[model samples]
Target: MTKATSAARDDRPPLLALVGPTAVGKTAVSLRIAEALDAEIISGDSMQVYRRMDIGTAKLPLAEREGIPHHLIDILEPEEPFSVSMFQSLCAEKIREIHERGKLPFLVGGTGLYVESVCYGFEFQGDSGDEAFRERMRHFAQAHGAEALHARLAAVDPSTAARLHPNDERRIIRALEVFETTGRPLSETQAQTRAAPKTSPYRLCLIGLTMDRAALYRRINERVDAMIAQGLVEEVEALIRSGVPQDAVSMQGLGYKEIAAYLRGECSLAEAVERLKRDTRHFAKRQLSWFRHMQDLVWAEADEEGKIDDLFKSICAIIAGKFHLDLEYIR
Candidate 1:
C-alpha cells in the first residue's frame, strides 16, 4: 500500500462528525450513532455551551442524551465570552480523552466554523486580543450602526461578510480587524489555512443530514414555537434578572435577543416571536451555505418520518467502508 494509504489506516481513533442545518435532526441522529458506537459526544455548537441558554439553542437535556457522556454543554455562564479557538482547544482535548478510553468521539452540531476548525485542524495564528482596536470597532459600530460596520467588512472581505449577519457586529469587526492587521482578507487567509497540506489531523468521517428546504423551514418554525411554549421568555428573564447584560455575547443569540426586546418594551411579544422565527430560518440557510463548502462529507436524507434507523444504517455502512471499522459491535 502507498504510504498515504497506510497512514490513513493508522491506529489513531477515527472521529465521526454529524453536521447540518438547524432542526435537521442532528441531535437525535448523533445520540443514536454515539450509542451504537459506544462513543462520547463533543458539541460543535457555539450557543449550546452556555449554562442557561438551553431551549433556544435546542440543546439536548441530560435526560435526552440517553446517558451518553457529552462535552462542552452548560460549561459557561451566559455573560462569559467564547470563541472558536476555545472550542477547538477544548474539543481536541476531549477527543484525545475519548480515544484513550477506547471510545469513539462524535463531533456533533450545526455550528459550521466550530466543526470545520476541528475537522481541518485550523491554526489560530492571530493574536487573541487587540483591546484598543476592538474598542475602536465597538465605538464605530455604536456610532455608525452595525450595518455600516458590516458594509466596511464587505468592502474588504465580501466572503466573510456574506457568511455573517449584519447585526453580528462582533464577528464583522473581527474580520475587518484581521484584514487591517494582516493586510489580507480574512476569507483569503482562512482559505490558505484550509488549503495547507497538514490540515486534517484525525481520521474523519463527516456525515451531513439534509432534506427538503421547505421541510427544514417548517421544523425550524415549529422549534421556535416549542421554545416559546417551553418558557423561553421566562428563561431569558431569569438570565436578565441574574444580571446578564442585554448586549452580552450570549444574549445576542436568536431567541434571547428577540425576547429581550419584548421584555424591554421595544417590541410586542408577537412581533418578537415572529422575528425570532424569521431570523432562525435565515440562520439555517446560512448554515447550509457554509456546509456546502466543506469537503468529503457523506450526505443522508432525513425523511419526514424522522426515523433514525435507516440513517443509522447508512452512516454505519459509510464508517465501515471509509474507516475500516468493525460494525459487529454496533448491533
Candidate 2:
C-alpha cells in the first residue's frame, strides 16, 4: 500500500462530524463550520456521492460550497454500488490528507451508517460475489419470500439478523449469501476485523444539528416545493431518460424515489409530494435517533429564522471545549 493509504488507515486526527436529518440545513451550517475551523469538508452522505444525482440528492453546487474544499461528493455514478466500506476507506484517506495539510477534517452530512462506520472503525468483509451465488440467493428470496430468506439468515447468522430490519430482506439475504459462500458468518468476520475504538488516528468531535420537529418538517416541506419549482420533476425525467435504474441506490434517495414513482404512474404527482414530505420527516426522526445513540456528539439547534451562523457558533464552542482547540486560530 502507498504511504497515503497506510496513513489514512491508521491516523485519526481532530475531526468534526456535522450530522443531522435531511433538509435540516446541515449544508449551510457545515459551510460555516468549515470556514470557521479552516477545515476541509468530507461528505458523510451516501447519496451525495453520485454524479448527475444533484437535484434529487440535494447535493451542494460548487458555488454553494463557498470555496470550502469538499471531499467524497459526486465521485460515483448513480448506477455503481458504493458501500460504506468504500466510504470509510476513501474518507480515511481524505482525513489523513487534510490532517497532513495542517487543517482539520470536518465530516458533514446526514448519512449515519457512513459516519458510524468510520467513527467506530467498523469492518466490512469483502463482497466478492460470484454470479452463481448471487443468483442462488436471489432465487431463494423469490421462491420463499424475503421473510423466509431472513429466517434462513437468522438460523445461520443471528447477530446480523438482530441488527437488520426484517423488511431489509435485501441485506438479510445478502448477509446469508456471504456466509454461505465464504463458509463464515458475516457478523463474525466483521467482529474479527474490528479495529480498536479511539484507536482511530483522529480526535473526533461530533456535532449534531437539530430543530423542533414541526419547524424541521416545515422546512422539509418548503424545500420540496422549492425543488419542484427548481425543476426536480424535470431532473428526474432526465435521469429516467438516461436509463438510470429505478432500483439504483441514487434513485432510492428520498426525493428521487417519490418522484420516480410519479414518473412511473405508481402515484399522482400531488401524492408523491405529500409522501416526500412525510418520508423526509420520518427520515429526520430516524437521523435524530441515530445521532442520539452515538457517543460524544454536541448538539446545536437551528435559530428561529434558521440563520446558520448561530448554530455554527454553538458548534465551534462545543468543539473548542472538547478538543481544547483555539477558536481564534481556527477562525
Candidate 3:
C-alpha cells in the first residue's frame, strides 16, 4: 500500500471504550476484555494521571494490571494540571501507537468528558487567559464560596453548571472566563465546535456497565471502607507533606479532598470517611446520568450476585458482532 493508503488505514482502527461510574468493576472487566483481544489499556481517568494518588484514585497497581500495557497513568505530578484537550491529544497518540503494534486500544475509565471528547473529536477552542479577570473571579469565589461561584456560572450557562460540581472551581473559573472573552456561553461555543462536520477517525465501540442502584451504592460504600483500610489517609498526608496544595485540582478529587479535610482537623476521620462515601455515591449518579445521554452505547448490566464473567461474555459478544472478530481467539 502507498503512504496515503496506509495513513487512511491508520485512522480507522477499531477503538473500544469501556466507561461507567466508579467502583462498578470496570477495571476487572476491562482487563478480561483486553487480555482476550490482546489489546492495550489507555486510562480515561483524570485523577489516575497524577503520581502519588494511588489509594484515593483506586489506581490499579502493576500487579493488578496482570502484565497488560496501560498508558496515561502516573504521567504527571500532583500539582500539574490536566485538561480534556491534553487527554485527547495524548490518548490519540497512544491509540495510533497501539494500532501500529497490531493491538487494539481500549479506553477504560468513568470520566465522561474525556471519553466523549475523544469519541466525538472535540476541537477545543483555546481560551486567552486574562490574569486580571481571573484574579477578580478568584477573589469573588474566595469572598463568597465555591457554591456562589458555581451559581454565577449557572446563571450564564446552566448546562455547564449542571455538569460540573461546585467544588470544581478551576473549571468554573475557566467557563466564566470563556464567556467574558467570547461573549458566548461556554456551552454555546462547545455546541458550535461539535457541530462542525468532522468525521471521527476511528471505528468506535462504546461499552457501558451498570448495575442495580442499591447494589452499586453498597459497592461504592464498601470500596471507600477498603480504601481507608488501605491507608488512604496516609497517602493524602504524604502528598500534603510533599507540598501538594489543599486547593490544587488533584486534592479536589473524590477521596483526596475528604481525607485532606480530616488531616487538617476540620473533620473527624469517621465523618470524613462517611462524607467520602456519600459524595462518591452522588458522583456515580451523575456519571450514570451523563452516560444515559450518550447515544449508541451497548450497556451491560452486572448481576446483583456480582457475576462479572457473565458481563464480560455479553461485552465480548457485542464486540465480536460489531467488529466481525472471532470469539474463539478471546476464549
Better of 1 and 3 by TM-score: 1
List, residue by residue over 1-331, the lDDT tens digit for candidate 2.
0011112332346777888888778888788777777789999998889998787778789988899999998898888878888999999899889989988788888988789788767767676666687778778878877688778889999988866544454567678777877899988876555423444456778888888888888888998899888889998898889998875667767788788889989899999999888877777887887788676677888764678666777787888776665666556
TM-score of each candidate structure, all chains considered together: 0.92, 0.82, 0.91
Off by over 4 Å in 3: 1-11, 187-198
- What is candidate 1's TM-score against the reference? 0.92
* Candidate lDDT (C-alpha), each: 0.86, 0.79, 0.87
**Candidate 3 least-lDDT 10 residues:** 1-10
Best by TM-score: 1
Identify the superior model by lDDT, candidate 1 or candidate 2.
Answer: 1
Write the candidate numbers in order of decreasing lDDT: 3, 1, 2
In Å, residue 70's CA in model 2 sits off its true spot by 1.1
What would the C-alpha RMSD of candidate 1 be, to one decimal place? Answer: 3.4
What lDDT, from 0 to 1, does candidate 3 have?
0.87
The segments of candidate 1 whose C-alpha lies over 4 angstroms from its true place after superposition are 1-9, 195-199, 326-328
lDDT of 1 by residue, 1-331 (tens): 1012223436656789989998899888888788877889999999999998888888888987889999999999998988888899999999999999988889999998899989988868645667789899999989998898989999989999987777777778888888988899989988876656644688888988998999999998888999999999999999999999877879888899899989999999999999999999988898887788788778888875688888888888887777765566466
Q: Estimate the lDDT of model 2.
A: 0.79
Error of 3 at 316 (Å): 0.8
Q: What's the distance in Å from true for residue 325, model 2?
A: 2.4
Candidate 2 ranges with C-alpha deviation above 4 Å:
1-12, 129-133, 140-172, 175-199
* Model 3 residue 219 CA deviation in Å: 0.5
